[model samples]
Target: MRKIIFICMVAATLFACKSASSTASTSTEATTLSTKLDRPTQVAIKGNWVLTNVTYPGSDYIKVNSFDLADSKCFIGSSWNFISNNNKGTMTLNSASCTAFTSPIVWSINNQGLFVLKIVNPGTKSKNVKEGYLLKVAGLTDTSFQLIDNINVGGQVKDVTYQFQRAN
Candidate 1:
């Protein structure tokens, strides 16, 4: 009788532990799915965008220029700009003629519906220009974004705002 009772007690304890473990595992799986379903989709800027406005410190200007984005490449007029990862390669401005310039920029988006572009100047061993640029997307639509360029000029900060409407 004593041996039978001891065996029953051990079996009951094992069953209880298994039940608790299964419940915990099930809840954890549900939580994982819930979190994944709640996550927002990432945004990618691709297609044609038009320039609408430019706001500067003392003046505001409207841009008649438009651009297109494909893959990681951006085409402005005749100029082509390529962005890979966080590195910006040399771009050629070819509205009519080709002019080459290099700008180091890091692009990111925030939860506050803002597309931020940070420009960093990586100096070469012989030449270096340490300048920074900040561009904020003020208003954004499915195919458009209003770009506000805040520049530091002559120790004073200025703003150049432009509207970009996606074309493609």
Candidate 2:
């Protein structure tokens, strides 16, 4: 009778442990799925986007420019398209002052969530620019996107933020 009682208790404890382990596994799976759904970066950033605004924030003051305004007319029709496939993209500018009318770009997002854009060998009319530029993604949505960068301006570190909107 004593042996039977001990066996029963041992079996009950094993069953309870198995039940708890199953619940934990299910909880972990759900959390992983939620994270994946919340961050749909590849899909969200794929589209034609036009620069809507640019801002420079300094220690003392902030300067903001709306691309639609007269002073920024040069960038009024400047746009970028992250193509359907994952690898390449394009930038087009309508301003006469721009050296290149259109440019081919190669782009990728790093694990750190920075957007890296590299202009391919530019055409003869284009000014040679450093191939790679990294922009920190501030926010991204179906219609709106924002990138932020910190750069040294006149020996002071300033933040430059760019806001973009879906062109279509």
Candidate 3:
């Protein structure tokens, strides 16, 4: 009986220490998903960056509402600041042709290499923002990175890529 109890305890401890990526969900809502920070990625992406480009299969023809905040074109010159220490940041839209916008954001890069972001309104708190976005982080380097989001186009799925470069 003593041996059996010890084995059970060891098993329980290991099970409880399981990584989140082993059971990560597909939910887009930040609050419902595991936003575990990838320390290496966190350190690499900490700084100000600009959305250099936004592209997809038919990007020229269709307009996508990126992050449900602004048109995809509006993000071309947008600025993003990621503070990895606390996983907080801000995204500012700089398109003079589109609606001017900026907002505080809470963000994290999960173990699954997903960038989870919640955009908080100017006067509203981030915790109250129920909706959020999850984008796959790809080709991340000290100077550049890309966030890839999938959207349904004409009943088919396509990837929308947002390229970012370190701001001078």
Give the candidate number with the greatest lDDT: 3
lDDT of 1 by residue, 77-122 (tens): 3221224343242323333332333443443343443343333445
Worst 10 residues of 2 by lDDT: 22-31
lDDT of 3: 0.82
- TM-score, per-candidate, Cα-based: 0.39, 0.58, 0.80
* Residues forming the 10-long window of minimal summed lDDT in candidate 3: 22-31
Candidates 2 and 3 compared: the better one by TM-score is 3
In candidate 2 the C-alpha lDDT for residue 156 amounts to: 70
Cα lDDT of model 2 by residue, 105-126, tens digit: 7665554576655566656321
Off by over 4 Å in 1: 1-44, 48-53, 57-92, 97-106, 118-132, 152-157
| lDDT for 127 (candidate 2) | 25
What would the C-alpha RMSD of candidate 1 be, to one decimal place? 16.4
Is 2 or 3 the stronger prediction by lDDT? 3
Per-candidate clashes come to: 14, 0, 0
lDDT of each: 0.37, 0.57, 0.82
lDDT of 3 by residue, 1-168 (tens): 999999999999988774444222223322344545688888899999999999999877898888777789889999999998988898999898998888899888887788877788878887677667778999988889999988887878789999999998
